[model samples]
Target chain A: MCELDREIRRWRRQEMRRSSLSPRELDELEDHLRARVELELELDARLTPARAFAIARDGLGETSVLSREFARAGAVRWRRALGYGWALFALSFLLPALRFEFTHEPVQVLSLTGYEVFWAAVTEGGFRHALCNLAMLLTLPALWRGRVRGGRWLAGGIGLMGLYLLATGLSLPRGGGGFSASLQVGYLVWAASFVCAAVGLWLRAREWVPTTAERPEA
Target chain B: MKKPVYKELVAASSRPMVLSILAGGESYGYEILKQVKVLSGGELEWSDGMLYPVLHRLERDGLIAGRWELTDEGRRRKYYRLTARGKRQLARDRVSWRAVHGALEMSWGGGHV
Candidate 1:
């Protein structure tokens, strides 16, 4: 991180020590302040970090005023994890994904959760399905941070895979069964999960476009 | 040659102004501030701290919803968007503001200043 970045973080920590503002609120303010500083720096190449930081800080108004405004407005501490929340919600739907029936002998029915199926796939060399799921899971944090380029489409593709699995039952490696497999409600739920993620990511992407586009190249 | 808008008028208009801007889409504090500056052509001056309270109040009234999200640069920002309730409120605000504007236009047009 640059010195200005460190300074901004330190300023946020200092405000947290003395203000009624929640950490999340402070985080918002900090980003606004940092944006102001970036604009200031970009507008004038000769501006020092201290000068730019001061300009941004003062532009944000006093901490006391902000606290009072928040109090008067009845601001409450709240957190939102848009993309992450949707991803986790999607993962939860996998709890009851598949039902297995044995047509041999005494007609037995066995239900398997997504977790069970995942492990079964892993042990049975069903690497393709396992890897796809793993890749989706691994990409979430990056998506949350907006680090993933073309993220909305990536999320949509994940949703499409879930839809494919829903339409066609989970394809696992041959395990010597004389039974047919059908997708359960979990597949549908997972599809909903991914759809939610795609929408959430797209909205997130939309919110930031103008800001980045408006920023003057320095 | 821009005339400064009175602080009272700004305060009175802040709620609808925010609702209207957010109706475009979800936006963060900084971006919203920039929009206000641009749209008003810098005639309306709002302190950065002043807007958050308005946002908080709107949220308290269920006129808007705020969420935290990271920018592509990984900076955390709190984005606010109009709720269904907020849209309805904005519509009502439009009707009232138009009434006021029309009344003023009539008076000004009739040389009543």
Candidate 2:
């Protein structure tokens, strides 16, 4: 509300637009700066508010270096979260994810685990689908390493695969031998992995977004 | 009043120092910096901004947990406390530090080699 506080707010806004740090990080840094500014003022009664603020900010280090350090730390955190997602995805395969029900006289029923469906897709005419799955799997490592291109590719892959899964899960697919395939509980769990990856990527992207106004460097 | 000459040593020791401080209780960034200065007798020189990244790393590694709380003055401040994992890490770190300290003490006591 005061003049110095307004100046600090302006500085925070500029840093937020220019740096990759999240708003929470900017807030934390702002709090630290304010504390240091107060201490500076206390140490030297002759120092003006602006001078105190400048001294405190300088002691906090350059924004460029701080941003770089935060980016590195964020990458490690994101990679760890992605690793857990990949583990969940890998484990989903061992669960029965689909059920095949025959409308024949015997009313026979068959169930396939995620692993079976994966292999079935590979050997069957769904080779293209298998390739898509493999490509999505490959994107995991690249995305984990915080590569922008990998994040984009993985987002696209998740979108396409999610749509495909949703469509298939919502409708009973009629195949040969009067059999209809319905998604089971395990299938939903497998689909949850996509949700996990999507959320992780979304959070990572949310961490850095520049404002439209290009304020000149402070 | 002598500033540490070795930047690497300062950086390496920061983690253990912070862990030991947090082991006493939860504290915020400015308070932690103050404690570090006091504990080091003003010998440990650290830029105010350098501590956040280290804290973030510690939080990410599960060594410390950070949470935001409103002070009685209505100021929102982030506080950090050591986790169980961090206590274990501090114990291990203490062993390593003492070993190095003992070696140095024995060598220095002889006043040579």
Candidate 3:
């Protein structure tokens, strides 16, 4: 292909990083750009493809601005995606709890489902454990809004909590070896919630990374 | 030579103009833009980059729809046309535009025509 086509392809590749714009949207945009160049050429035969491409590109708009718009649009969409994932996971946690909701004072998940481990967390775990889950829940909105700084906060929060759990779980069992296995399992189960929060934060963090065009603003 | 229209004026009117053009039939960016220049005799000078955002904003607002089609020559093109909602919006816009046009014309003492 010509330089103009090659440049258009290159721009599309860069724009793909935005993730908000679908492949079809990018294809449509490229077609629109190509059409603009063709319009320039039709008006003046002597115009070089590069010159025509430049004019067309200028008229079509900068890739960065367009990408920002797309990114903004994408962020709105990602909220829903993050929301669905959170909802499903939350449901997995809440579903078993539903039947068990009012019936049990301190709930026990009898099923061997991997997710019962999550339910056991909220009901059987201590106040501090529930507080960690609460922190994880609250940080989600900030991350859903696509704030990278919040991701930083989330990483620090979850990492410290995870470390704390390991320290305490190992040390608290010094009363005897009797409490070791069950306590370790409980710690793992509760920490899984923290892990879920971290994973959610990580997904949004990808969206938070500044594009080459946006980094200068920082 | 004609005076260039104010940027804000172009920004203000471009949406109605674009929506009205789409009401005529399905057309792509390049064609709609060229038509605007030809129809206005170059008075409505808009930045090249601004139109897409306007179109996108309109699309996002659900006033229009876009699709891609391959031409007889085997080239793919993106085309936009009005929606029913767009048509309803256009009718309302037409009334508003005419009111503004009448007011301006009356101010200029051309109301009798």
By TM-score, the candidates rank as 2, 3, 1
Output the TM-score of candidate 2: 0.65
Clashing pairs in 1: none
Residue B97's lDDT in candidate 2: 100
Writing each residue's lDDT as its tens digit, candidate 2 over B59-96 gives: 88889997776655445678899999999999999999
- Name the better of 1 and 3 by lDDT: 1
DockQ of predictions, in order shown:
0.28, 0.18, 0.12
Which residues of candidate 3, in runs, are more than 4 Å off? A17-21, A70-218, B110-113
Measured against the true chain A, the candidates' chain A TM-scores are 0.55, 0.54, 0.40
Give lDDT tens digits, candidate 1, residues A1-218.
38787788788778756665645567767788888888998999999877899899998888877866765684322112345535554574566777777789887888877677667879988886676566467446544333355656765676676567656655543346587565666655655555556555555445434232222234
- The CAPRI classification for model 1 reads as acceptable
Candidate 3 residues B22-107, lDDT tens each?
98899987788887888788899866656676777777678988766666545566678999998998899899999998898897
lDDT of 2 by residue, A1-218 (tens): 27568779888888756665666677678778888888898999888888888898889888878877876664454555555556667776888888988888899889988788878878876675466466557556445334444465566577567557655663347687588787877677666666566656655555444222222224
The weakest ten consecutive residues by lDDT in model 1 chain A span: A208-217
Which of 1 and 2 is ahead in TM-score? 2
Q: Interface Cα RMSD for candidate 2?
A: 9.4
Which candidate leads the pack in TM-score? Answer: 2
> What TM-score does candidate 3 reach?
0.58
